[model samples]
Every structure is written in structure tokens, then in C-alpha cells.
Target chain A: MTDELDRDLLLEFAKAEQPLKSKEFTTNVMRETQILGNRKKRSLWLYGLVLLALCILFAGPLVKLGTMFAIGFISPLVSFENPWLATLTMPVNNIASIVVAMLIGGRFIWKKASQ
Target chain B: MNNYQETSEAGIINLARTGDPRAFEELVHRRQSIIRNLMRRLCNDVTLAEDLAQQVFLKVWQSIAQLSRVNAFDGWLKRIAINTWLQYLRKNDAMRNSLEFNDTVYVPPPGSNGSVAMDLDKALLVLPEQVRTCVVLAYHEGMSHPEISEAIELPLGTVKSHINRGAKKVTEMLAAYKQPTAGEKV
Candidate 1:
């Protein structure tokens, strides 16, 4: 239902009129870009350093946890056990070992499958 | 840059892709007007338009490396501009669910062609932001519905309806001006 008059009016308004142009516009954009660039550089360095520090700080706990899990996993495979415990407390020891092995194995499979 | 002064837009884009600030600044200078004008009309606010323009350029600079085709620069830049404005509109919750055909009558100057355009500009400000965008892009920028849908990230049907409703509203509003005032000398 649009008429010629409406079309003409819109075209007239559409004609480019740069009333807002100023040298400051370009300068402001460039300045903002410069500030952002500097901020990005600083943030990248900070993030990298923070990540490295976190890994270093957690290395001991992470290694200890991994070793504990690895021992549980290996005990099932190796079947190495103290002779005295095997004789006197064989059932309880076996149950504890089985529980540990299942927990560790399930966790390892979940992590690997997710990755 | 003096070296980049006569370079084509594609050449400048390539340089900007590689982190040349001068080239990016040059790109901004070249495309600033169209982007600013589109934003100004879309927002109907000069200050917001300028702010949006800056954001569009900043986004373009940030994502310049992703633009594999140099010829798609205009389309890409416009999409960013439209998206930025749409985002602003969304954040403000300003999209009107229904078009309000305001009763303010435009009294066009007698025998003057420019008055129609001037009054139309004023009339445009009263439109809902989404319709105003579609109207401006369709009539002013001469964009097709598919192009507009792609740029605005709206469905094609939605773009068509907005353009139709917007144009109808504007035409209806302007229809009032064509009638002679009661006391005017014939």
C-alpha cells in the first residue's frame, strides 16, 4: 500500500548528510582502540602468569592424589599383599581393595571418556 | 599510513588483519559515515548512534581476521552494526509489541518539496525501533528482505512484516499532510 510520495520522502531522508563529522571522531576511536590493545596485552600476561602459578602451587597435591589412585589401580593388577593381613583379615582387606579399585577405575574412565 | 593511503580496502583489510593499527584506523575513517548514518536513523538518537558506530568499528577491528573474503567487508560490517543496535534494543527492552500510530499531524510547508522529507524524518522518530530499522534499511539503504534478515538476524517473514507495517504506518501518517488545512486559501 506504499505510495510514490512515501517512497520519495524516505529517499530524501536517506540522502547522506554528515552533520556530525569532526576530526575528534577518528581520534577518539583510535585512542580507544589503543587503550583496549594495551589492556588486552596486560590481561594476557596476567592470565598466563596466574595459570602457571596455580599449576605450580597445586603440583604437590595433584601428584599425591594421582599416586594414591595409581596405587589402588596397580594393587588390583599386581595382587601384592602382606601375608599376615591376607591370612587374618583377608575378607575385609579384599573388600576394601575391590571398592578402591572400582572407584579409581570408574573415575579414570569418566575423565578419559569426557575428554 | 602513507603506504596505506592509496591502498584498496582489501589491502587495508589484510593489513588490519595482521594487527596494523594504522590500517584499521584507515578502514574506520573510510566506512564511518555510512555506519553512523545507519545507526543514527536506527536509534533515532544522535549520541547513541555515535556510540553504536564506535562499537561497530571496534567489533570489526577485533574480528577482522575472521573475514576471509575482502568483498564481504561491507556486508560483515553492516551485520555487526545491526547486531549491535539490536543488542542495545534488547538490553533496554524497548521493542514495542504494537505499533502506536501517533495522532500528531504533520503540516507540510506550502509548495515546498523538502518539507515532505523533513516531516518524514520527524515522523520516522515516532516508529518502534524494529520497524524503523526495517523501514530505513529497505527504503533508504535499498536492502532486500533476505539481506535485511541476514543482517538483523531475524526471520525473513519477520523482516517482511516489519517493512510492510512500517511502510504502511508511515504512508498513513503522511496521508494526513496531503489534505489541505481548513483555513488555507485555495
Candidate 2:
């Protein structure tokens, strides 16, 4: 009986242990965790945006070169059908247009990179 | 208690990992009371206990994702709490100085009823930090000897020895208070 009583008393004392009451404890912890979570999300989005920008920056030259090759290959067919037209306008106009588009794209990329 | 079970500590941990701040807060609310009590017993200073409690929760928040195997949540939190307390003891020069000075001659004032509860708190304070941690984790936190050993990173034999020695010392202290000294007249 004595042993049982001692055991009971010990258990009761253990059960009574409690944490302190901080008025803003929960609020403070939640706010901090939320901020951390948001920061993680923002960093992931930033990474995605950087990858997209790189794709646009490098794909521009490749696409322009491909377009120039396609025009050159089709030039013979067009000249065979209309000799006067081919003689009047050299393919330099196509190359110039490509160069101008590239210049504009490059200016935009440089502006973004500076920012 | 399906809702309670569904919101069980494991559930709360999962939710907290998925960015549910409310779930993390719920976990804190559920465990804070016991944690505060443990801190109070360990530090024997309410203000310090409160501070340590906050630090414990902050750590729990920061490391929630690293907690795998949800069943061990309580044990994991207890380990964090113990480590946080130990770190605080190590870093705070003033507390370290006080602890060293007080260790030899610390005694509770007379006249209060020698309640088992009060005696237990005082007894816990008199123990060395590692022994006190083992005792508190074993008795107060309902952890087994193995659990206490794991939480405090001590050997199993050391944990057992601390519990035995701590309980014996507390028992002796309480017995001394119960028996009157010869010089005093009732």
C-alpha cells in the first residue's frame, strides 16, 4: 500500500508540470514560420524566372540562324519562278532584318541583365 | 477523438511541414504546458523557464522538416528541449557563475509545507545538469531509461545511475525535512 501511494504521488506530480503562458507565443512562432515558408517559395520562383530568361536569351540567335538557312534554301525555287524579282532584291534584306531583330532583342536582354 | 487523432501530433507535424503555420501552433499549444513545467523544474527560475520554452519552440519550428517518423515526435522535442537548456547553461556566463556558487549551499527557505511537489522541484535543481536531465526526462516526461539515454546522449548505465542517485538524494532531502531537528520545540 505504501509503495502504491508513493507511485501515485510521483505520477500526480509529473502530470502537473506545465509550460509558461506567453501571450503572443503562438502568434510569434506562426508568423516566423510563415515568413520562412514565403521566403522559400520566393526563391524557387526566382530560380524559375532566371531559367526562363536564359532560354529566351540563347534561343534568339539559334532561331534567327535557322530562319536564314530556310530562306536561303527556298531562294532558288523562288528565283526559278520569278527571275526579275530575285534580281531586284538580294537576300541581304532578309539578313538585315534578322540583324535588326537580334539588335532589339539584345538591347532588351542587356537592360534586364543590368536590372 | 478522430479530430484530435487526425490533428494528432504526427498529423500536425505533417501539416506544419506543408506550410501550415496553424498546425505548428497547435503542436506548440499541445506540448507547451508540459515543456514549461520541465523547464521550470530544470532551471528553477520561472523567467528563465519561460525564455527557454520559447527557444525550444523556435527550434521546433526551424527543424520541423527534419523530423521523420512522426511517432517519435515527443522524444525528438524532448531532446531539443534538453539540448537547448544545456546550451543556455553553457552560453550564459551569469547563470553559470550563479550555478557554481549556489551548488554547495543552496537550500529552500523554511516554513512552506513540505509538499512533495515543491520538494521535487528543489531536489531537481540540486542535481548536476546531466543527472537532472535524465531524472526529469525519465520521471516528468514519462520516458523510459533507454529514451532518457538517447535524449541526453548518455550511456544507458549513466542514465540509470543518474535516476537512481537523483531519486535517492531527493528522498533523503525530503526525509530530513519531515523529521524535526532536536534544537527546535514544536
Candidate 3:
């Protein structure tokens, strides 16, 4: 006779498994839930906090710069009859937009990467 | 979660369902091993098993309010464990069709050979994710085929076939560990 068993022996083995003992398993899970369970709310508050700070820090300067920019470009175009409106249309505003976009994108990427 | 009071498991689960942190922590302590072991069998990686176990518990904590009966905790926990594993597989695209998936041969853990139980675990590792899941629920968890279908959200017939096919494959895989009849020789 060939080597064989009369029963599906895998059952006994399956039941015989001893769970791997983990130290502080409950503690670790509890810690993760506390830290991460509210991640969506936390991330929302984080972005809001960052945006609020950016607004607080740069609002005055940005407003001042914007007004100066508008006056400089529009007034010049109006008075000088400048044909280079296309050229003047973008540069500074685009830089400011790019800066804001980078701040938001950088924060997002940093948060995701860290997680 | 600080207050320590010993109570019946159902009481703790009820308190946990009501968002009582201490009760929740107690529940976690009681059930963590079962979930952890189930995850370990599912993934076959210690770290990922622990991570998935954590996710399972986290989901339990977040949705314990939705659990209708405290007595149903075991089934609820097993369902969560399976879903957590399934999500991980789907997220990683780790469980593609067998022919298209890069099959990772099971490397038997040290001191795990010879014994049928150990060999069975190695055999389980050889199965595709969905099939292995059905097999594990049936054999390891002692769940009925219909129960497995409900747990894993597969059709009844599909679950039955997966268990059948998986059981046969595992038996074949373990044939090497079979004991010899009286006159049989190496």
C-alpha cells in the first residue's frame, strides 16, 4: 500500500494552531484607532489650519501686491495703449497661483507620504 | 478607555456598542487573538497580519453601533476580518486571476514540515486568495459553506465549489506527508 491517511488530517492541524502571542496588541490597536480613526476630520482641520495661517500671514501683503499689480498693468495698458497685454497678463499672478498650489500640494503629499 | 471593571462579554460588547471606550478596550483584549490568528492565516505574513488585525478592530470600533446582537460578535468579527483581507487584496491588486497573477510559492516556515497541520498551512498558501478564504472559513473556522458565502459575499454555489476545489488541492499538496501503510517503505 502507498503512504496515505484515512482522513482529511488537515482539520486537526487547523484546530491545533496556537495564536501568535503579541505583546500590547490591544494597546497598539487602541492607539491606532485614537490616532487614525478621525483622520478625515483631522486632515480637514489640518488643511484649514494651514490655509488660515497662510491667509493670516499673507493676506495683507497679497492684497497690497494684487492692487499694485492691477494698477500697474491696467493703468499702463490704458494710458500707454500697450499691445503687450498678453505678456503682462500672467507673470506675477501666475507665480502667486503657483505658490499657493505648491503649498497645498506639498502639504497633501507630505501628509500622505508620512502616513 | 481607562476604567477597569470585569463584566460579562455581552455586557462589554453592549457598552462598546454604545461607544464606551473602556468597554471597547476590554472587548478588543478578549477578541484580539482570534482576529489576529485569522488574519495571520489569511495573509501568511506576521506584520501584515497584525496591521490587518488592527484595521479589523478599528472598523469594529467605528461601527460597533451597527452590530445588532452582542451575541453575534464572533460572526461579526470574522466578517470584518475577511472584508479587511479582501480589501487589502483588492487595493494592492494582489489577488488577480491565478494565471495572470505572479504566483508566490509557499516557503514553509521553519520546523513546519512533516506535520499535517503545518503542511496544511503551507498548502493553504498555495491557493488563490478567494479560494483560500473559503477553505479557511470552512476548515479552520468551522463555518458552513452557506455561512462562508454570506461572510465573503460570494454566491452559495461558488463558495461550495471553492471549498471543494481548495480542499482537494490542499489534500493533494499534503499527500507527501501521508503516513505509510504497514508494509509500505520509503
Best by lDDT: 1
Clash pairs for candidate 1: none
Task: Give the C-alpha miss distance for residue B134 in model 2, angstroms.
Answer: 2.3
Model 1 lDDT per residue over B139-179, tens place: 76677788778877778898888888778777766655455
What are the per-residue Cα lDDT tens digits for candidate 2 across A1-115? 1111136436645545544574476666667667776898999999999999998898999889989887764444233346677666555345555676799999999999999
lDDT of 2 by residue, B1-186 (tens): 235335766677888766466677778777887778888877777788878888898888888788877888887888888888878866763222422222444465444576655666775667766666656666666678876677656688877887777666656555554555565565
TM-score versus the correct structure, for each prediction: 0.71, 0.56, 0.61
Give the Å error, residue A26, model 3. 1.5
**DockQ score of each predicted structure, in the order shown:** 0.22, 0.18, 0.17
Candidate ranking under lDDT, highest first, comes to 1, 3, 2
Highest DockQ: which candidate? 1
- Residue A97 of model 3 has an lDDT of 56
Model 3 lDDT tens row, A31-103: 8877775896889999999999999999999999999875654432222245476456545345455566799
Candidate of highest TM-score: 1
Model 3 DockQ, alpha carbons vs. true complex: 0.17
User: Candidate 1 lDDT, tens digit per residue, A24-82?
Assistant: 77788898898888999999999999999999999899999998876664443334368
**How does chain B of model 3 score on TM-score?**
0.76
